[model samples]
Target: MIARQYLERAGLHFYAANVTLRGGELDLIMRDGETWVFVEVRYRRTSLYGDAAASVSYTKQRRLLHSAAIWLTERGGSFDTTDCRFDVLAITGSQLQWLPNAFAAAE
Candidate 1:
């Protein structure tokens, strides 16, 4: 619910992707015109280990990329690197942080 609102406010049209695969589950898959934005929505009431965006470790990025591949292949769309980016919608308490192109798969 919060994730949807954040995306909507950002002026990006999106949909929740339910890719119940083996490893990971992406929170929301968004569309920004020709760009395919894979959003990872995270919330933490208290910052114990790190911020919500920092919680998305390297392993999680791999999982997101893997799920995205599965989604694209299943949808049968031509693969291209146009404006693809990984976004993180971090929520801590009532504060919201939007990190665009947070990290890459190699990270």
Candidate 2:
């Protein structure tokens, strides 16, 4: 919710949220101009192990990619034509870091 509000204030148009699929859940979906953005929100009360962004592992990235693909397909969109990106909203305590183009689908 904080991430969504932050992004909205930053001028990203809100599209969807908490999109659950068989692969995984997409925390947020937004549009920056013409580009579709798939966002993952990670919150950590403390960084004892690692930062919130570091918590998104390779497996999680794969799952996000799969889920995004399915979502686009269901909405009659294709990666070949739709400009899309993956983003991460990492929250540590009261700090929020927005990382755009955080990952990409494997070629």
Candidate 3:
């Protein structure tokens, strides 16, 4: 995918893609040095309602959090120790925007 290539070119190491969990899916999983990044890719042909990133509602963020937790658990990782972040790749028409550390897991 173009998003994956873009991230890789920016120096993030690819770990996984299209990771499916019980509640949601992670479009890309990458590593920036020691940080684990969970990326959500959103695409829109036109911004009739809102941009692609804006489509990720609160409920969707919660689902992504749940899925990320499960993914980490399955890999013997812990949220307490593992440094992780959520990112969003928004694609609208021919424009692409990458938002890193876009959201955080609720405390």
* lDDT for each residue of candidate 1 in 1-107, tens digit (9 for 90 to 100): 87777788889897765546657787888888878888888899978878788898888888888877677767775236345678999998788999988876445
Shift in Å, residue 90, candidate 2: 0.2
In model 1, residue pairs whose N, Cα or C atoms come closer than 3 Å (at least 3 residues apart or on different chains), thus clashing, are none
Predictions ranked by TM-score, top down? Answer: 3, 2, 1
What is the model-wide C-alpha lDDT for candidate 3?
0.92
* Candidate 3 lDDT, 15-104, residue by residue in tens: 999998897898899999999999999999999889999998988888888999999999898677789999999999888999998999
User: Per-candidate TM vs. native?
Assistant: 0.85, 0.95, 0.95
Error of 3 at 87 (Å): 0.3
Better of 1 and 3 by lDDT: 3
After superposition, candidate 3 runs with Cα above 4 Å error: none
